[model samples]
Target: MKFLIAFLAVVAVALAGPIDERGAQIVKYTNDHQGISGYNVEVETSNGIRTIEQAELRNLGNDNAAIVVRGSYSYTGDDGQVYTVNYIADENGFQPEAAHLPRA
Candidate 1:
Protein backbone atom coordinates (compact mmCIF):
# COMPACT_ATOMS: atom_id res chain seq x y z
CA MET A 1 0.00 0.00 0.00
CA LYS A 2 2.89 2.32 0.78
CA PHE A 3 4.37 1.62 -2.62
CA LEU A 4 1.06 2.34 -4.28
CA ILE A 5 0.88 5.70 -2.51
CA ALA A 6 4.40 6.55 -3.59
CA PHE A 7 3.72 5.60 -7.19
CA LEU A 8 0.59 7.73 -7.21
CA ALA A 9 2.54 10.67 -5.84
CA VAL A 10 5.01 10.38 -8.67
CA VAL A 11 2.29 10.13 -11.25
CA ALA A 12 0.53 13.14 -9.77
CA VAL A 13 3.68 15.21 -9.94
CA ALA A 14 4.29 14.26 -13.54
CA LEU A 15 0.76 15.28 -14.45
CA ALA A 16 0.48 18.20 -12.04
CA GLY A 17 -0.19 20.68 -14.84
CA PRO A 18 1.31 24.21 -14.72
CA ILE A 19 4.45 24.66 -12.67
CA ASP A 20 3.09 27.60 -10.71
CA GLU A 21 -0.14 25.87 -9.73
CA ARG A 22 -0.70 23.63 -6.74
CA GLY A 23 -2.01 20.16 -7.32
CA ALA A 24 -5.01 18.39 -5.88
CA GLN A 25 -5.51 18.79 -2.15
CA ILE A 26 -7.06 16.56 0.43
CA VAL A 27 -10.71 17.22 1.18
CA LYS A 28 -11.19 14.72 3.98
CA TYR A 29 -9.07 12.26 5.92
CA THR A 30 -9.38 9.87 8.81
CA ASN A 31 -7.13 7.22 10.27
CA ASP A 32 -7.22 4.92 13.26
CA HIS A 33 -4.23 2.74 13.88
CA GLN A 34 -3.19 0.58 16.80
CA GLY A 35 0.12 -0.87 15.76
CA ILE A 36 -0.03 -4.65 15.09
CA SER A 37 -3.65 -4.72 16.23
CA GLY A 38 -4.77 -3.16 12.88
CA TYR A 39 -5.94 0.06 11.33
CA ASN A 40 -8.65 1.82 9.40
CA VAL A 41 -8.08 4.68 6.99
CA GLU A 42 -10.16 6.83 4.70
CA VAL A 43 -9.31 9.76 2.50
CA GLU A 44 -10.77 12.00 -0.18
CA THR A 45 -9.19 14.56 -2.41
CA SER A 46 -10.16 17.70 -4.24
CA ASN A 47 -10.21 15.58 -7.33
CA GLY A 48 -12.62 12.71 -7.60
CA ILE A 49 -10.32 10.27 -5.83
CA ARG A 50 -11.20 8.42 -2.70
CA THR A 51 -9.74 5.51 -0.72
CA ILE A 52 -10.96 3.48 2.21
CA GLU A 53 -9.23 0.61 3.97
CA GLN A 54 -9.69 -1.49 7.07
CA ALA A 55 -7.51 -4.18 8.57
CA GLU A 56 -7.50 -6.42 11.59
CA LEU A 57 -5.26 -9.01 13.11
CA ARG A 58 -6.69 -12.48 13.29
CA ASN A 59 -5.25 -15.18 15.42
CA LEU A 60 -5.14 -18.71 14.05
CA GLY A 61 -4.19 -20.21 17.43
CA ASN A 62 -0.97 -21.97 18.39
CA ASP A 63 0.91 -18.66 18.39
CA ASN A 64 0.00 -17.85 14.83
CA ALA A 65 -1.79 -14.85 13.43
CA ALA A 66 -2.08 -12.68 10.38
CA ILE A 67 -3.30 -9.29 9.33
CA VAL A 68 -6.30 -9.33 7.08
CA VAL A 69 -6.79 -6.19 5.07
CA ARG A 70 -9.55 -5.23 2.67
CA GLY A 71 -10.06 -1.96 0.87
CA SER A 72 -11.28 -0.18 -2.24
CA TYR A 73 -10.18 2.95 -3.99
CA SER A 74 -11.67 5.00 -6.79
CA TYR A 75 -10.51 7.72 -9.10
CA THR A 76 -12.11 9.62 -11.92
CA GLY A 77 -10.60 8.90 -15.32
CA ASP A 78 -9.91 11.29 -18.13
CA ASP A 79 -12.82 9.79 -20.01
CA GLY A 80 -15.13 10.77 -17.12
CA GLN A 81 -15.69 7.24 -15.90
CA VAL A 82 -14.97 6.38 -12.30
CA TYR A 83 -12.53 3.51 -11.93
CA THR A 84 -12.48 1.56 -8.73
CA VAL A 85 -10.61 -1.43 -7.32
CA ASN A 86 -11.40 -3.66 -4.41
CA TYR A 87 -8.67 -5.78 -2.91
CA ILE A 88 -7.71 -8.10 -0.10
CA ALA A 89 -4.34 -9.07 1.30
CA ASP A 90 -3.71 -11.71 3.89
CA GLU A 91 -2.34 -15.26 4.22
CA ASN A 92 -3.55 -16.09 0.70
CA GLY A 93 -1.74 -13.11 -0.78
CA PHE A 94 -2.94 -10.07 -2.67
CA GLN A 95 -6.20 -10.37 -4.57
CA PRO A 96 -7.64 -7.45 -6.54
CA GLU A 97 -11.06 -7.25 -8.13
CA ALA A 98 -11.74 -4.70 -10.81
CA ALA A 99 -13.24 -4.58 -14.26
CA HIS A 100 -9.92 -3.75 -15.85
CA LEU A 101 -8.04 -6.73 -14.45
CA PRO A 102 -7.51 -9.73 -16.70
CA ARG A 103 -8.94 -13.12 -15.82
CA ALA A 104 -6.76 -16.16 -15.21
Candidate 2:
Protein backbone atom coordinates (compact mmCIF):
# COMPACT_ATOMS: atom_id res chain seq x y z
CA MET A 1 0.00 0.00 0.00
CA LYS A 2 2.79 2.47 0.80
CA PHE A 3 4.53 1.76 -2.47
CA LEU A 4 1.32 2.33 -4.41
CA ILE A 5 0.68 5.61 -2.62
CA ALA A 6 4.22 6.85 -3.30
CA PHE A 7 3.96 5.98 -6.99
CA LEU A 8 0.63 7.77 -7.33
CA ALA A 9 2.01 10.86 -5.60
CA VAL A 10 4.95 11.01 -7.98
CA VAL A 11 2.74 10.64 -10.99
CA ALA A 12 0.43 13.38 -9.79
CA VAL A 13 3.26 15.84 -9.28
CA ALA A 14 4.72 15.18 -12.73
CA LEU A 15 1.36 15.72 -14.39
CA ALA A 16 0.63 18.89 -12.42
CA GLY A 17 3.83 20.63 -13.55
CA PRO A 18 3.13 20.22 -17.23
CA ILE A 19 -0.48 21.32 -16.83
CA ASP A 20 0.60 24.51 -15.10
CA GLU A 21 3.12 25.33 -17.82
CA ARG A 22 0.54 24.77 -20.57
CA GLY A 23 -2.00 26.95 -18.80
CA ALA A 24 0.55 29.74 -18.47
CA GLN A 25 1.39 29.54 -22.15
CA ILE A 26 -2.27 29.79 -23.06
CA VAL A 27 -2.73 32.84 -20.88
CA LYS A 28 0.32 34.53 -22.36
CA TYR A 29 -0.76 33.92 -25.93
CA THR A 30 -4.24 35.23 -25.22
CA ASN A 31 -2.74 38.39 -23.73
CA ASP A 32 -0.24 39.08 -26.53
CA HIS A 33 -0.56 41.13 -29.70
CA GLN A 34 -1.19 38.41 -32.21
CA GLY A 35 -2.24 39.27 -35.76
CA ILE A 36 -5.36 37.96 -37.41
CA SER A 37 -5.67 34.18 -37.18
CA GLY A 38 -8.19 31.98 -38.96
CA TYR A 39 -8.73 29.44 -41.68
CA ASN A 40 -10.67 28.76 -44.84
CA VAL A 41 -12.74 25.68 -45.51
CA GLU A 42 -14.53 24.34 -48.57
CA VAL A 43 -17.21 21.67 -48.77
CA GLU A 44 -19.01 19.99 -51.62
CA THR A 45 -22.69 19.18 -51.63
CA SER A 46 -24.98 17.36 -53.97
CA ASN A 47 -26.43 20.60 -55.26
CA GLY A 48 -23.29 22.69 -55.23
CA ILE A 49 -20.36 23.78 -53.09
CA ARG A 50 -19.81 25.89 -49.98
CA THR A 51 -16.82 27.84 -48.74
CA ILE A 52 -16.12 29.71 -45.54
CA GLU A 53 -13.37 32.21 -44.75
CA GLN A 54 -12.84 33.46 -41.25
CA ALA A 55 -10.34 35.54 -39.28
CA GLU A 56 -9.94 36.83 -35.76
CA LEU A 57 -7.97 39.57 -34.04
CA ARG A 58 -7.28 39.49 -30.35
CA ASN A 59 -6.86 42.37 -27.91
CA LEU A 60 -6.12 40.66 -24.67
CA GLY A 61 -5.28 43.83 -22.83
CA ASN A 62 -8.75 45.13 -23.48
CA ASP A 63 -10.18 41.67 -22.91
CA ASN A 64 -11.81 41.77 -26.31
CA ALA A 65 -11.59 39.93 -29.61
CA ALA A 66 -12.99 40.57 -33.06
CA ILE A 67 -13.91 38.14 -35.77
CA VAL A 68 -15.01 38.38 -39.38
CA VAL A 69 -16.43 35.57 -41.43
CA ARG A 70 -17.56 35.30 -45.01
CA GLY A 71 -19.24 32.30 -46.58
CA SER A 72 -20.71 31.37 -49.93
CA TYR A 73 -22.97 28.58 -51.07
CA SER A 74 -23.06 27.91 -54.81
CA TYR A 75 -25.58 25.78 -56.58
CA THR A 76 -24.65 23.50 -59.44
CA GLY A 77 -27.04 25.25 -61.79
CA ASP A 78 -27.92 28.51 -60.04
CA ASP A 79 -26.05 31.62 -58.97
CA GLY A 80 -24.60 31.44 -55.48
CA GLN A 81 -24.98 33.90 -52.64
CA VAL A 82 -22.37 35.11 -50.21
CA TYR A 83 -22.91 36.15 -46.59
CA THR A 84 -20.74 37.97 -44.08
CA VAL A 85 -20.78 38.45 -40.32
CA ASN A 86 -18.77 40.41 -37.78
CA TYR A 87 -18.36 39.52 -34.15
CA ILE A 88 -16.88 41.03 -31.02
CA ALA A 89 -16.11 39.04 -27.89
CA ASP A 90 -15.39 40.53 -24.52
CA GLU A 91 -15.87 39.67 -20.89
CA ASN A 92 -19.59 39.77 -21.49
CA GLY A 93 -19.68 37.30 -24.35
CA PHE A 94 -19.66 37.11 -28.11
CA GLN A 95 -21.76 39.65 -29.96
CA PRO A 96 -22.35 38.99 -33.63
CA GLU A 97 -23.91 41.08 -36.36
CA ALA A 98 -24.58 39.99 -39.87
CA ALA A 99 -23.42 42.34 -42.56
CA HIS A 100 -24.96 40.50 -45.49
CA LEU A 101 -26.91 37.56 -44.15
CA PRO A 102 -29.70 36.29 -46.34
CA ARG A 103 -33.22 36.56 -45.01
CA ALA A 104 -35.83 33.95 -45.59
Candidate 3:
Protein backbone atom coordinates (compact mmCIF):
# COMPACT_ATOMS: atom_id res chain seq x y z
CA MET A 1 0.00 0.00 0.00
CA LYS A 2 2.78 2.44 0.83
CA PHE A 3 4.55 1.77 -2.44
CA LEU A 4 1.34 2.17 -4.41
CA ILE A 5 0.56 5.49 -2.69
CA ALA A 6 4.03 6.81 -3.43
CA PHE A 7 3.82 5.75 -7.07
CA LEU A 8 0.43 7.33 -7.46
CA ALA A 9 1.66 10.55 -5.93
CA VAL A 10 4.57 10.72 -8.32
CA VAL A 11 2.33 10.00 -11.27
CA ALA A 12 -0.11 12.69 -10.25
CA VAL A 13 2.64 15.24 -9.85
CA ALA A 14 4.17 14.36 -13.18
CA LEU A 15 0.86 14.57 -14.97
CA ALA A 16 0.10 17.95 -13.43
CA GLY A 17 3.27 19.30 -15.11
CA PRO A 18 4.89 21.98 -12.96
CA ILE A 19 1.56 22.80 -11.31
CA ASP A 20 0.52 26.22 -12.59
CA GLU A 21 -0.07 28.01 -9.33
CA ARG A 22 -0.78 31.26 -11.19
CA GLY A 23 -3.75 30.74 -13.52
CA ALA A 24 -4.89 32.96 -16.38
CA GLN A 25 -7.01 36.11 -16.56
CA ILE A 26 -8.16 37.92 -19.72
CA VAL A 27 -9.64 41.36 -20.26
CA LYS A 28 -11.25 42.52 -23.52
CA TYR A 29 -11.70 46.03 -24.74
CA THR A 30 -14.70 45.93 -27.04
CA ASN A 31 -16.15 48.66 -29.19
CA ASP A 32 -19.84 47.97 -29.87
CA HIS A 33 -19.99 50.74 -32.43
CA GLN A 34 -17.83 49.05 -35.01
CA GLY A 35 -18.44 46.74 -37.96
CA ILE A 36 -18.34 43.71 -35.71
CA SER A 37 -21.12 43.17 -33.22
CA GLY A 38 -20.71 39.65 -31.92
CA TYR A 39 -17.06 39.41 -31.03
CA ASN A 40 -16.22 36.18 -29.25
CA VAL A 41 -13.30 36.06 -26.84
CA GLU A 42 -12.04 33.24 -24.63
CA VAL A 43 -10.44 33.85 -21.25
CA GLU A 44 -9.30 31.63 -18.37
CA THR A 45 -8.72 32.76 -14.78
CA SER A 46 -7.21 30.53 -12.10
CA ASN A 47 -4.69 30.47 -9.30
CA GLY A 48 -2.86 33.70 -10.19
CA ILE A 49 -2.62 33.78 -13.97
CA ARG A 50 -4.84 34.66 -16.92
CA THR A 51 -5.01 33.14 -20.43
CA ILE A 52 -6.84 34.27 -23.53
CA GLU A 53 -7.90 31.46 -25.82
CA GLN A 54 -9.67 32.84 -28.88
CA ALA A 55 -11.52 35.96 -29.82
CA GLU A 56 -14.36 35.81 -32.36
CA LEU A 57 -15.62 38.69 -34.46
CA ARG A 58 -19.33 39.15 -35.16
CA ASN A 59 -21.94 41.67 -36.04
CA LEU A 60 -25.09 41.81 -33.92
CA GLY A 61 -26.48 45.20 -34.79
CA ASN A 62 -25.89 48.04 -37.19
CA ASP A 63 -22.32 49.21 -36.93
CA ASN A 64 -21.95 47.64 -33.51
CA ALA A 65 -19.58 45.09 -32.06
CA ALA A 66 -19.68 43.05 -28.86
CA ILE A 67 -16.78 41.07 -27.52
CA VAL A 68 -17.43 37.40 -26.67
CA VAL A 69 -14.65 35.75 -24.69
CA ARG A 70 -14.29 32.16 -23.49
CA GLY A 71 -11.50 30.25 -21.75
CA SER A 72 -10.54 27.88 -18.91
CA TYR A 73 -8.16 27.90 -15.93
CA SER A 74 -6.56 25.00 -14.06
CA TYR A 75 -5.47 25.10 -10.44
CA THR A 76 -5.02 22.92 -7.36
CA GLY A 77 -7.68 23.79 -4.84
CA ASP A 78 -7.28 23.74 -1.06
CA ASP A 79 -8.63 20.18 -1.10
CA GLY A 80 -5.54 19.14 -3.08
CA GLN A 81 -7.61 18.31 -6.12
CA VAL A 82 -7.06 19.72 -9.59
CA TYR A 83 -9.85 22.12 -10.47
CA THR A 84 -10.64 23.93 -13.71
CA VAL A 85 -12.29 27.30 -13.89
CA ASN A 86 -14.26 28.39 -16.95
CA TYR A 87 -14.53 32.10 -17.64
CA ILE A 88 -15.85 34.47 -20.29
CA ALA A 89 -15.70 38.15 -21.07
CA ASP A 90 -18.71 39.59 -19.27
CA GLU A 91 -18.54 42.98 -20.90
CA ASN A 92 -16.23 45.07 -23.07
CA GLY A 93 -13.88 47.40 -21.29
CA PHE A 94 -10.40 47.93 -19.88
CA GLN A 95 -11.47 48.46 -16.31
CA PRO A 96 -9.12 47.00 -13.71
CA GLU A 97 -11.90 44.78 -12.31
CA ALA A 98 -14.33 44.71 -15.22
CA ALA A 99 -13.91 41.02 -15.84
CA HIS A 100 -16.04 40.10 -12.81
CA LEU A 101 -18.92 42.29 -13.91
CA PRO A 102 -22.21 40.69 -15.00
CA ARG A 103 -22.66 40.10 -18.69
CA ALA A 104 -25.45 41.39 -20.88
TM-score of every prediction relative to native: 0.72, 0.31, 0.35
Ranking the candidates on lDDT from highest down gives: 1, 3, 2
Candidate 2: clashing pairs of residues: none
Q: Largest TM-score belongs to which candidate?
A: 1
Model 2 lDDT tens row, 12-103: 98965522222322111112223556545554433233333344544634645555444444323223344444454444565656645444
Report the C-alpha lDDT of model 1 over 1-104, residue by residue, as the tens digit: 99999999999988765432157889999999988789999999887789999999999454669889999999887676899999999989999999977979
Estimate, for each residue in 1-104, the C-alpha lDDT of model 3 and write its tens digit: 99999999999989876655445344433233333334333333444333434445546554665666555545455667665555556456432223334666
lDDT of each: 0.88, 0.46, 0.51
lDDT value, residue 95 of candidate 3: 27
RMSD in angstroms, all models? Answer: 12.8, 17.8, 9.8
> Which scores higher on TM-score, 2 or 3?
3
- Candidate 1's C-alpha runs over 4 A off are 1-22, 60-63
Clashes of each: 0, 0, 27
Error of model 1, residue 77, in angstroms: 1.4
The Cα RMSD in angstroms, rounded to one decimal, for candidate 3 relative to the true structure is: 9.8
